[model samples]
Target: MFPSTEEGPEDDSAKHGGRVRTFPHERGNWATHVYLPYDAREEFMDLLDTLLFHAQTYVPRLVRMEAFHLSLSQSVVLRHHWIHPFVQALKDRMASCQRCVPRAPLCLSSPSPPRLPFLS
Candidate 1:
């Protein structure tokens, strides 16, 4: 997950260019990745809340996520200029594909094309 605020000097995240890097950094390059967004059902939200309540007892700072997704690709680098075109191309390809619908909560449990609401 990406955070807007700086991790501070005590945080070693700033060392070696960044906390971790898949490829060498370049001035105009940007990191990119793909994922399947999920819209949790009411049942899942309830379950998550119950889990969070118990988890907060141990880790009080734990924050609830507004949304989450299943990562489909590892981090990849792209030129800043290519960002928009790359997204548009991905959207075009996805628009042509058929959507999958599975009753199970996790989409990765399904075959080939994942069964997720956003992918549709």
Candidate 2:
């Protein structure tokens, strides 16, 4: 990780901080790994809450998965020029990566019963 001009320790500056990490996981050839900067976790959660709240009423499965899930709806609030393009690009990327387009119905329902969050 290199440093950027904007913040924190030289090693933790924004430009360098925003860099994402990727590696091949030993678990499987198809399993690529990603590690987001630690500081971004909280911001991610904030955005997640906003997305979940906005999508909840429209997606019953979302309500069912409330305990743990990611709602891509937050992408809707990204720069106006980016919204549709980003989604389309994501779809294209997924299609190429998976080697086939998935035809299953979109479902957000949890596969298992909800579990309580661990709080300390």
The top-ranked prediction according to lDDT is 1
Q: lDDT tens string, model 1, 11-108?
A: 34455334455456565778777888988889889999999999999998676788877776656678999899878877887887788886665544
Residues 1-120 of candidate 2 have per-residue lDDT tens digits of 344544432333345334332332221123211112223346657887789888877984453222343332311123445456555765565565433343552556532332211110
List per-prediction Cα lDDT, in the order shown: 0.69, 0.40
Query: Model 2, which residues run further than 4 Å from truth?
Result: 1-65, 70-77, 99-120
lDDT of 1 at 3: 52
Worst 10 residues of 1 by lDDT: 110-119
lDDT measured at residue 103 in model 2 versus the true structure, 0 to 100: 52
Highest TM-score model number = 1
> What TM-score goes with each of the models?
0.54, 0.22
